[model samples]
Target: MLIETLKNRLVLACLILIGLYAVVSIGGTLFFQYEPNSQDLLQANTGPGAVHWLGTDYLGRDLLARIVYGIRISLTIAFFATLINITVGFLVGSVSGLLGGLADRLLIGMVDIFWCIPPFLIVVMLTVVLEPGIKNIFIALGLVLWIPTARMIRGEVRVIRNSPFIKFARLNGAGSFQIMARHILPNCIPVLLTTAAFSIPDAIMAEAFLSIVGLGVQAPNASLGVLISDGLQSFRVYPWQWFFPVLTLTMLVLCFNILGDALHEAYSSKAKGLLEHD
Candidate 1:
């Protein structure tokens, strides 16, 4: 299954791009000459050059370094938020599907209530209520963005729970926990992966939006959104400040989007093949 998915050219390309971003973000300091926050007023607003690979921002901070560091911060926040989303969504969905009737209805109702509110709005409100910082943003995003994942997981769990194999397991005196842990959860891996792939870009974009509006990562700390916001101030004179970050963000999001689509297609085709064989 993994081999088949990797055979896709689009998926391979996306993976490579994402890998490059991760590597650069992780080891950027080794290659870059300047720290993200280190300022040199003499070099401020300069275009791309040998000294500043992607040029310097209004404060003369290295654009390339800031971008790489910003990518690290953005990816970090998105990764953690997605982690929380998966954990909470999986637990709620598994319990809801495994124990039906009142529990199912109540859980579904709660999900629906959250679903009705725009996720970004909920995140914004949460951020406002909490103090503005990276940790708060992570908490805000995680709390609000799990609705879609939970819904998808719930539906998948319900279907798996109704399968003949699950019924047979039950008849064999398997406990609910055993059925869920040993049987149902394994079958839901594809769904979880697909949902998680999609959820990452959403989390990245959400962090960016919050930073742009001044409700996210504060000054001196760079995020893609923070970079873009900073660039906007000097856009007319020095476009590199705005352009590089925007381009980076676009590529980052595009990579995730394509990867998610590819995973969805790969998983769907696999499932279809299995059904036809059966």
Candidate 2:
């Protein structure tokens, strides 16, 4: 079944990478327990050797330790923000699609209005207004990211509502909530899940960009973005400072993208099968 494939390959890979990140994040607290911001200029700029696996930065903090913690924080932000995006998107889309007329028109128009605004600009402006921290980053990213997701879900919902299944559900005297929950929403799950996978990397990169601009995760809290920002200042002298964080971030993003693509294909195939069955 499609579920088996998702588990065997795409979902499994994502889970494994997520698990590795968790281990690095949680294990560090028990072992190194190195304060990510505690500076030790004496041990600064050391390359990977017997002691440090990824080496120390200009501040002499363990790069590996900081990155581990940073990944934890970065992933946390992405996961939660994306969750909020999907929730809002799904709700708005479902309502717009299931309830046609002026309400649907107004909702769809609002989503389009949101889509017209540049997401990055909105995030930057919000970051400027809000106090900097992990939570603020989450809010900024979620607020902007939901627009695209809502658009996609709305499109999908519009298509599904016209299908025979929806008509059948309505003919059975099903309530709006019952029809959506029992028929429309279940059909939309694969699309929603795939879209969610794609959103994670976007959220991650957005967080990094926000941090680089000095509005994201504040000092003392480790984030891949903040780490890269710090690394850039000394990039010429300590190329390793930039190299490792960038490499790790690249791999994480790449993995998520690949997983998203794979899920999308699989979902499309499943969607096709469901149609055939109907």
**Local error of candidate 1 at residue 12 (angstroms):** 0.8
Where model 2 places Cα greater than 4 Å from the true spot, the runs are 1-4, 7-15, 31-33, 162-173, 274-278
- lDDT (10s digit) by residue, model 2, range 230-266: 9999999888889999998998888788778877878
RMSD of each predicted structure: 1.3, 2.3
TM-score of each: 0.96, 0.90
Flag regions of model 1 displaced more than 4 Å: none
Q: What is the lDDT of residue 243 in candidate 1?
A: 94
Clashes in model 2: which pairs?
none
